[model samples]
Target: MNLFHFSDEGSIDVFLPRVKENRKELPPVVWAIDEEHEFTFFFPRSCPRIVYTRSDEMSDEDRRAFFGATQANIVVTVETGWYERIKRSTVYRYRMPAETFELFDTIAGYYISPRTIVPLAVEPYGNLIDRLIARGVEVRFTPNLHPLREAILNSTLTDFGIHKFDNAARA
Candidate 1:
């Protein structure tokens, strides 16, 4: 599981064992910590990365910086799988309530998804992507580049026919 601090300076050492030993995936839990304990949760790229927060509220600049830092820390050579995962699960929790809608709009504005399926149209689906795209979140979408686009294009043109979109609306 990835622990996000959402900070530019702080660090946490997440326990990520080698795949050969442990066959468990990381748990998803967001831990908000006070500055009382010594930070033992720091690790290199070989381990899972944790994102820490610098202040009580995250500003637009902070959000952009945090995304950049995470991308830099978690470096992967491949892209396809990751991109698909993002498209499937791009939801994120934000600090401010009003900004949630704003974030969703931004995500839709940025990534040009060939998949006409508007994720934002779903509940909380559009929130994270919108914020990320609006603030210029630098997530690598190499997996979603060509093949996915082609599949989407082919699907839209011939597979489902022209009325499938309308049919889906009624359902």
Candidate 2:
């Protein structure tokens, strides 16, 4: 399977292993996502968002409550303020050879390499929001993600990611 790294900047030539400020408990490593879950990064970095999908453990009641009749298996939600930025944003997808990376988070599709690496190629994706919708992702915009976050955390929507949520608007 192909692996990729997405960034707002496009001039990256080398990816060095570095610990993220927010995730100090983990060792320094270069992060990449597999092609199947690339949709997870289809937004401006630091955009406080939540993405989730139906999991085998999820009850039918929860599935119907969260995904009504939507055909999209994946659902992503961001605060209302990020809407305009999402519409105008452009992200660069850096393709990486998966040989040097090891599976880090299986459910998240994350792979990590302890050593530095070079991207095979970089491709630009503009009209970020449009691209996400085109890929069959149900996109949502809410004024405050606090309630949703609490709901998902308390519920069975376990196959999910809440990225940069510390930056989300307070309730």
Candidate 3:
């Protein structure tokens, strides 16, 4: 399986194992995403986003409530304040050696490694909105993520991810 790491930096010689401030409880590790869920990182590093997908086990009622009439299997929501940044930002996609990583969160397509990692290659990615749309992903822009956060948590959206919420706008 192909694994990747996304960054805003144009050039990266190597990726070192490190603990994020929010993840200090865990050991330092390199993070990578599998090809299937790379869409999760198609934004600036600190851009808060909520991503949800239609699961195979989803009930029609839950699907209708969460997905509405949209045919998109995946929905990604970001605050409106980040819209301009999302458009102007250029993120680099770094291919990683799958052998050095192990599955971390299967649902999120996340992988972790205790050892340092060197990217196999790096490629610049732009047109974030178009890329997401081309992949049949519905991208949403909201003023605040607070309400949506609570709704998703209480709803049947099991296949969902709330990212960098601490950086999200306050309600």
Candidate 4:
């Protein structure tokens, strides 16, 4: 399967994992939809947030309020057979698009889109790349720098500097 990740230009050549030493607290291994959507969903610690109509309806103020001050980043694509395996092994919770919502059950972590699945904890993601590599995954990077020149320029998370990884690089 082809999975997509978005990140800043500086990280185009690197894959940064949420390691205990660097993060102190564990974080999820996140990815975005390969295709575009009017709204992009994020589950930062099981609290769902949406970056809605970033290129259209949303105002700059709302963008900053909802997504913070950030610019476009690179998009990463990886081909792996692990998505299903990971999804199946992990327990997930999801939500639909709405203007506002309150968080429930703090431990599940957040997931966007009606059925977007995510693991309950960050532990499995700790060695996600390793598992992907063990399963023979191929990772590739695509830079989303030029707003007028790239397809991903319109992606909701483009300005958020999302990052993706290629396990092959480690080998």
Pick out the ten consecutive residues of candidate 2 with the lowest summed lDDT.
126-135
- Scanning candidate 3 in windows of ten residues, the lowest lDDT window is 56-65
* 1-171 per-residue lDDT for model 2 (tens digits): 899999999999999999988779989999999998998898898899999997789988889887888877899999999999888989999999899999988889999998899999999988888878888899989999998899889888879889999899988
TM-scores, one per candidate = 0.22, 0.96, 0.95, 0.20
> Residue-wise lDDT of candidate 3 within 1-171, one digit each (tens)?
999999989788988999978779989999999999999999999999999999877777888877898989999999999999999998999999999999989899999999989899999999999999999999989899999899888776679999999999988
Give the winner by lDDT: 2 or 3.
Answer: 3
Give the Cα error of residue 12 in candidate 3, in Å. Answer: 1.5
lDDT of each: 0.26, 0.91, 0.93, 0.29
State the TM-score for model 1: 0.22
Q: List candidate 1 stretches off by more than 4 Å.
A: 1-30, 33-78, 90-127, 142-171
What residue runs in model 2 are displaced by over 4 Å at the alpha carbon? none
| lDDT value, residue 49 of candidate 4 | 21
Per-residue lDDT value at 41 in model 4: 18
Could you tell me which 10 consecutive residues in candidate 4 have the lowest summed lDDT?
Answer: 38-47
Q: Is candidate 1 or candidate 2 better by lDDT?
A: 2
Residue 26 error, candidate 4, Å = 12
Q: Rank the candidates by TM-score, best first.
A: 2, 3, 1, 4
lDDT of 4: 0.29
User: In model 4, which runs have C-alpha deviations exceeding 4 angstroms?
Assistant: 1-20, 24-78, 92-157, 161-171
User: Global lDDT for candidate 1?
Assistant: 0.26
